[model samples]
Target: MSVDEVAALSLTEVAHKIAAKELSAVEVTEASLQRIERHNEALNCIANVNAEDALAQAQKADERLAKGGPVGPLHGVPLAHKDMYYRAGRVSACGSKIRADYVPDITSTALKKLDAAGALEVARLQMVEFATGPTGHNEMAGTPRNPWNTDHITGGSSSGSGSAVAGRMVYGALGSDTGGSIRIPAYCNGLVGMKATYGRVSRYGAMPLSFSLDHVGPLCRTVRDCAVFTQVIAGNDPDDPTTSREPVGDYLADIEGGVSGLRLGVPTNHFFDDVDDEVREAIQESISIYEKLGAEIVEVEVPGIKHGFALGEVLGRVEAATYHSTWLRERPEDYGTQTRNRLMQGFYYPGTRYIEALNLRGQLLSGFTDEVFSVADILIAPSVPMAVPTIADTDISANQGFLDMIARFGSCTRPFNFLGLPALGVPCGFTGNGLPTGYQIVGRSFDEATLFRAARAFERETGCTENAPVL
Candidate 1:
């Protein structure tokens, strides 16, 4: 295959090729780096391109493989990540001016796991300021333009991860989701992104947004790829006490198990409240496909999600303000205007409400899961409520309507974050306006395998994923 073709290969394809020695780690790394150089200016999906370091790592991988050592599953596959994941000595901007020159002294457990698995990280992707926004806008670092249509938003926090993966500059990217950061971009850019059950992955060495809500996950082109990446980076971490001690299942093993006979829930309440015709139709089409595949669709009264977004907003803002209290107080001028405006709201919230929200989480998770999962193995809903909005339309910095638009954009996703359930964003179809949209498959806590099985079944039947955004 040509260099561009090599660069465009998905994560599993790249891993298989490199593992078989049909392609060298150097070749894959170089191909991705070349793609990044050619396309990054327009996409701006990456913040710091680690050309020299990546190539050196690639060379080392080649030497190790040549010596016939046990190979890492990701050996030599080049990947990029949102700027929030810290790597010792590498700049992790977190898409904020305050951290513009900050470099962490330690690497995130997730990155270390990926590194041990032989994934070569090629770049640090862009993000919203302190990962505070839902839209891919960062006035301090500039918003990353959508690869499919540069005029649109790439979705936020995980903005660059979506852009880079969709643009075919990287195999996959690490992204954090507190309030839809991972899924929003996955929906907008047409990729697969999963916010694993909270505490499923370690948060050690990663930047904090909301200590209670932040989750780390991947954005990839397919369900299998999402499963593959998640496998390597998931499970217990001594550094992170919040991490689940439950053994990491082989996500790929049962992925092809398909969704046959599984009960999929469609919430009759909150999920579809503001869903547009196009959004509703695409997801319905996916549901119809699943129905034909023998998956049972059950409509259920799934309550509590209605309160999830607002509760998450309160917790996130309060925790964020607390985390950045020093920064917000000391370097108030460092944050983007929109981020500052948003973060400052945390300060005004009553501490009693924050505690009440925190205390209510377990009851909420219990009630919601008991009701929904009791009737369904998985829950399916639209990832984005409306058609993917243009960057200008969602730009809170420029538009007056964005205040309402932001909440609506995250309406479906925020609840999962609050509930700490595993949710995957699967690209099902494109909107009439030519932008991308998808359905979210939320699984029971620690049951990401079900989410993958269901999504992979849909993907196989529909062939929804697209490569090489029309940049």
Candidate 2:
């Protein structure tokens, strides 16, 4: 297959092809490297490309396949990830200048699992400094550009993951979501990203912005690809006690089961308050699509949802501040303007307020699920409330507009993080500006399978996943 043909296949498709011997692992890896070499200069999405090591691994994968031993589901696939997941003896910059040279002795559980699954780590992708920003603006490391429109923002902290995958540079990439890091980028870049329920995946060896809100997940071109990736990385880990002991479900088993007889809730509250008209129209159209797919669209009230964002801010900032206290005290100069400023606020949050926020999460989650999920199997909302903004417009400075825009970026996504529910962002349509916009479907904790099923149904009906940025 040609390089473009190889790049065009979804992660799952490429994996199948490699296993079936239609494409050698070396050919696929070389194609991915070619795309990165050609496009990374323009998009600024790749932090560091491990060309030699990746090619060597790909050769080994092919050799193993030739031996006819049991092959993993992700056998011979190439993937890049945000610059935060640690691999023993390798640097994990976490998109910050402070950690640019920081190498860890421990490999992240997620990466280890992916390595075991026969996935190759081709590159380390760029991200917001310390995973603190929503707008993919990393001053120390260059900001990643959206592939769809080079001048626009790639909603971040998973900035490069979104850019690389949507730009067709890599099959898939792991993205960590804390306050919508994964979903926002997915929305802006027109890919599917899932922020699984907190504890659904282990966070060991991954950089942490917020202990309470941090979630590790994947950003992929399609929902099925996302499902397969998530399936590989998810499950209990002995190293991270926070990981849930709950059995991981087969996300792909019934992904094509369709949404028949399912109740999909459209919020009558916070999700639409300040949403742009174009975005609202796209979401409504998606709801109509769901209604046509044998799913019931119900208007449901989300009780106590208004406080979610603020409470999440309190808990998140405190946790973030606690994590960075030492760095903020020393080597503060190394941090970027926006990340340093954002992390600084975490210190000022009163202990009482942080405690209160933590205290309210379970109460709010219980009330939210009992009231909303009781009436509907899933809740659908805009992944981002506004159209994708220009990089120049959202570049962080001492501007009130920048703050408002950043806050708006996370408005729809952070709530789910705070509530610790599983949320998946799927491309719904394009906005007036010709940029992509998406909707997120939220499900009860550990219920990612249903979210996948519903998203797959929408994807199948609308064929929205067929659109990709012409990088």
Judged by lDDT, which candidate is best? Answer: 2
RMSD of 2: 0.8
| Model 1 lDDT, full chain set | 0.89
**Worst 10-residue lDDT window, candidate 2:** 396-405
Clashing pairs in 1: none
Please count the clashing residue pairs in each candidate, in the order shown.
0, 0
Off by over 4 Å in 1: 398-400
Off by more than 4 A, model 2: none
TM-score of each: 0.98, 0.99
Q: Over the full model, what C-alpha lDDT does candidate 2 score relative to the true structure? A: 0.93
Model 1 Cα lDDT, one tens digit per residue, 3-39? 8889778899889988888999999988998889889
